[model samples]
Target: MTSNGSIATTLAPTRETLSSSQLLSSSISSLNSSSTRQASSQISKIYRQASTLFLTRRLPESLSTILPVITSPAADDTNPDASPEPAPISRASRTTRIKVWSLYLTILNAIVELDPDEGKQAFGSKEWKGLVNKVRDGDVWEEVVKNGYGGVEGDVDSDVVINLATLLLAHARTQKVNQTRLESYLAASTNPSLDVSSRLSTPTATRPHSRSLSPVKGSGTDTPRDLNARVKILELYTLHVLLRNNEWDYAREFISISSVLDEERREAFLQALQSLQEEQMESERREKEERRYQEEQLKRDVEEARRRRIESEEREKREEEARNRRSEKGSEIDYGVEDSPPRPGSSKSRSSVKGGSVKGGRSLPSSSPTARSSVPAKNVKVPPSLLTRAGNVVMNVRKLVESMAGSFKTRPMLLMQMLGFIVGILVLLSRRDVKERVKSILGKGWGKVRQTAGMGVKVSYI
Candidate 1:
């Protein structure tokens, strides 16, 4: 009985073991399905919230809300001390995945375009510069590829690719990296390892993963929608991006050889390319002309300023020379006056008679012996004869009369007043009583003058 029980335990399948295995498998599958659904719902919710925040112009909040949905967890994020990892984008539905990435790229573009102060205020200085640098340096493209497309460049969604190229074209400092990335994507997309026929014949279970399973609907020319998207991508690559890089010949060749475009579309694209080239050339010519005009204007302004400065300097110089000439002439006149002989009746002769020697009609310094000898002795006295004194009085009276006559020529009213006063005096004297009074006054003034003269003669004799 013991051997049989051990054998049955070893060989026979227990109902509990069978039931447990089945239950474990079902539970694992249910857990995976529930987790996928939860991730999808969460991504949709985050996308809606971020998009709403973006539309409302709340960029910082939108960036914060959408970052986790698009970014993968760091390698060290498994530690308890590390922040919790976000759900990988691959787990979400196709539509939700595209929406999340599109919102993220848009947020990045908006942040990059913000004014310096606003960007700094919205995101701190270091963070703002970092985000801007990511766009301008074309690192954002790499991030999208690595984080969103599982490091597969061709696996990126068509719409996402459009947004990436547009963002880089708008902000990147160089277009080489963008062009190379586009070419690689186009090469990978156009030259699929397995053609459409092969992929169709292959069993779904064994078929390798391709861009069909990407966030975009279909790969290459699989459907009309896919074809339209391909056309758009080609338009962006050949027209916008290649033009920016100045790859005209390569662009034309690319358009001509493209299998997707029909004859009509090809003709249209070629014509558009030609028109764009012409327009670009015209714009370049206009810009060159404008720059040349500005340079000439600037040169003219500088020359005009210089000319004005020189004229002002010359005017000032001429004025200064005129002033110097006037000063020199004045100085020469003064020196000549000091060195020339004095005139007979000038003030210099009068001054010379008092304190300087007069020889040859020139004044000499008083310190000279001749000047001392020429000066009159202080004690010398010479009395004038009566005739000489009477002659001097006559000359003074004549001078006074001549001065009065000259004054009368300039002022007729003053002359009239003087004449009227004289007439009045004569009229008063005409009266007998006035004549007798005037004769007595004259007799008394004459007696006083004779007495003063006698005293002056006595003093002179002594």
Candidate 2:
């Protein structure tokens, strides 16, 4: 009743492809076919001699052999005789399935060696790092395999084992191979059913031979237990495949099954594969998108930080310039008395006022007209020598600044201001009284020195 669905039949090789012939025939065919007549005969003789080494005689009466028998169906169609007994059987004489046993032993070792927390250990190494890597990359496996333990490199032996095991498991999974029910299949076939009681059973034809309705055997066809076995075998053999394969072409080899199945089963297996493929694609896409998003966000953050940093630097520069501008304006009215000389006859002693009253830390002269002769001092006035000297200094500074401007073309605004200052200095230099005041200041610089308000900053000619 159980039939293996598409998953089982889709990839498993058939009997003809896997080669159901005897070992002798298979061996001969596999050998080099370019031999001369004499060598070919010699090879044939050797094969014939070797094949006879195994003991195989006719099976006895009372026990039927599993293989097909070549006997004719009936001695006569008119009358029936008691059916001849099948081959005899010896209770103690049972043939062991040697391949299955060996397979089981291998499976046992693989399972026992497998670690949940770690992978399988390579041939000699304690660490399963080789197992973590691919099969061909395992050094221990290579050395041991070269020493003659593992199968030949580039062979499909591992793939065959796993595929076969998986097929067996698929059979156990009770997957159906066909869509039609047993009765419907029977009806469709050429075999005509007769009443059991009226007609005697024929020994040769116990079972009907109908290709259309052949019963699907779960043993080698469809069973979940078979699938479990196959999965284990696949996992185990993957190690071998990794170790031996130079190319993975063989791993991809699978059957294109022509066997028809029920619509429900076909739809189900296709759906499962579809879902698995979809999930894998989705995961990869998500990872790619996440990486791209992170990169873009990082770029945006960096750009924003740079923009902020530039703005802050500009603000700081502007503030520094403003403070410098205020300081420059303050320089117009000298804070340090020594930095700018006083007008003639206006002040003398800078500290204690020698023989004159101290006013605002300056000493006045005893001969000053403003202090004594106030009866008719209309013509009395201050000298302009000091003022003249200060005006000359300003003129010299303007020349020096214009000469400095020759070395730079930037800061045009600052250049214009310098030009304006030059004009102001020129006007001051044109006044006749200012010139006299400057001359007097140069002759009698104050009677005595006054207190120093601040350190003097000289604008030297150099």
Candidate 3:
């Protein structure tokens, strides 16, 4: 006693409350009419009843009632018109067949959750192929496609493949079926003519869902949004399946050629991909920077270690030199003892001298060479002190200046000033005659400065 049964009883009281099985039987019984129109009308009625059953969750009964009408097989397990000849079916029958195919596929998609393998088998059965082939047999196929049957039109072959692929992809994604079936669907959907070489070559801003393109004429139409919804769903499912299979290139190509996706969706997809790329680049950049920093730090550490080693060697050399000097001084002090006979009255003095020398030897500085020489030399050179080297450097500079001053032409302005200073010193040391000549030159320079100033041109003597 479902709602449909209640509704059936209310519509026709001659029938008591019908069970699901009874309702299914009643729908199928009236479909055997001789008139084509009557048969099609009965199918339409059965389609509505099946839809109701589906809503009420009586999927098994709904499928059982719908499949026979759609398949129309003479036998239970085989298609009678496996190789359908050129049979002239009426326009109404053709349309009804198309509707039945659509409903069948829809019901199959819905019931996939119940029995995925059975749904797959049903889609692959000869009954399904026979229906599709029969639809394409005559001009009726073209007319039905052009007029659009059950919301599918234009690009019918590709759309059919996409829809089947979408269904299989859903089953695989939900783990209801093996994922390998998606590969077959993907292969069927891919057409060479639709392949894209670059993503940028594809349109970014897709047309809104309100418009539809007729594949045959490339004309606009106010078609229902169902086709667009299916196309987009297929694209998304195909993309997910391709990614899950690790078909990265195929996924990119699919998105590039996807005409059903809206602009915001495309942007979101590209943005997610772009963000992934950015994350990888950022990780690489950080790794490179870390490596570089480590290298620089190692170099600095090596240099610091080298500098410390050099300083340590210099300190050891200085210590060794001090020890050698102390040892030499001690030897000199020991050798300074006189070789004279001991005086009989000064025996105490001789003994005292011997004892003082022994005490001195024992009390020698620790830096003495005889104390220790086991320390190794580091073969380091000590530079001469600046104070000790300054006189030689000064003498060399004086020689260079003297040589260059032999000719005034080789002397710069600084050398000329020095020469003038020397000349003045020489004149001061000379007699009154050289002093008078210097005084005449200074008076002439002062006279020239005064003459320039009197002429209103400013001048100064250096």
Candidate 4:
């Protein structure tokens, strides 16, 4: 009975498995018919909404809105904890996928182009810097490959590749990495590896629903639109990016050997490259000339300034020397005036005069040697000449008389009294007895003065 139960249990599970497989197959068949139309419609709706947000300058919202449609459940989601991963671009219809990716790239480019403050305000500093760095460092290309192309370089759509190259060109500082990435993609697209063994072993029945839904396009250069896009990519790589990197010869070789470019297009590209090279050379020459002119002008300005400064200093020095010379000359004139001998009739000479009598008086000379020798030689100043001394005295007397006369003009009564006294004196002198008495009195006073002087002289001699 136990063996019978085991067999029944195993048999039941097998039937259930068969039934589940049949249901899965039927569901897949149904999905294949309708999934393409449904996915295209859904992608169109999502793309329109995201494009509207982007046009309205709502970048973060656009990024958020578009993310879900392009991502799928993670491969490890069986654990119920793994996060969703980005969906491969091949999962969407070709046109929708290109539109979605172009919008996404444009949004990223816009975000990178935002003013730092505005970017930081919309997305915090860390997030904004991360986005900008992703674009600038050419990491966005790798991201598109890994997330959108299932890590298949050759599988990247031409339009999407063009967009990626454009984005990197606009923001990236270096083009070497971009150049290498483009070269790899071009090589891979041109020479795709065919894994015959993998294809033979993997039966068409067990293939993923997504693969059946979106078949891979045969070649990039098949359609006219595809050819044009491929040519554009080449133009960007050769004309824009390679020129920036100065890979002139390599660009020429690439254009020459490119399978997509016709002979006419090839000639046009070469002529353009030649023109660009000439323009670059001309621009460089102009820049060098301008730089040299600026340097020379700067040097001339410095020299001019230095010369002016020196001239100013020299002028000041000359002025100072002239001022010093004038001061010295003035000082010498003052000293000369101070040290010069006094003039003949000056007040200093007048004070030096001695032993000069009044105008009508005669003074006796000193006979005693002791009197002559009494004064020290250094203390004795030479008297002015007799005539000059007399002239000065006469002038002084004349001035005094003039001053008296001027005073009399203001007081007539005082002048009259003085005249009357002089008349009285003259009338008294006219009397003989009066004249005799005046003469005797004058003689007596004169004799007494002579006697006193004689006594003094005798005493000194003794």
Best candidate, TM-score-wise? 4
Q: What is the lDDT for 327 in model 4?
A: 100
Tens-place lDDT digits, model 4, residues 1-462: 899999999899999999999999788767753675676788899899999999999998998898776655456745766434546344567677879889989999999999999999998999999999999999889878776666678877888999999998999979987898998988887777567576446443333234322234454788798788888989999999999899999999999988889999999999999999999999999999999999999999999999999999999999999999999999999897555555666544444344433356753334433323332234567889999999999999999999999989998898999999999999999999999999999999999999999999999999
Q: What is the lDDT of candidate 4?
A: 0.81
- Rank the candidate models, highest lDDT first: 4, 1, 3, 2
TM-score of 4: 0.64
Of the two candidates 2 and 4, the one with more favorable lDDT, higher being better, is 4
Question: Can you write out model 1's per-residue Cα lDDT over 237-296, one digit (the tens) per residue?
Answer: 899889999999999999999899999999999999999999999999999999999999
Residue-level lDDT of model 2, residues 150-231, one tens digit each, is: 1222111222334333333222222121111111222322133334543234332222111111222222223564444433
Distance from true position, residue 238, model 2, in Å?
15
What local lDDT score does residue 154 receive in model 1, on the 0 to 100 scale?
75
Q: What is residue 162's positional error in candidate 1, in angstroms? A: 0.8
Q: Specify the poorest-scoring 10-residue window by lDDT in model 3.
A: 204-213
Between candidates 2 and 3, the lDDT winner: 3
Tell me the RMSD of model 1 versus the true structure. Answer: 21.1
What are the Cα lDDT values of the candidates? Answer: 0.80, 0.37, 0.52, 0.81
Where model 1 places Cα greater than 4 Å from the true spot, the runs are 1-38, 74-87, 194-211, 214-219, 328-462
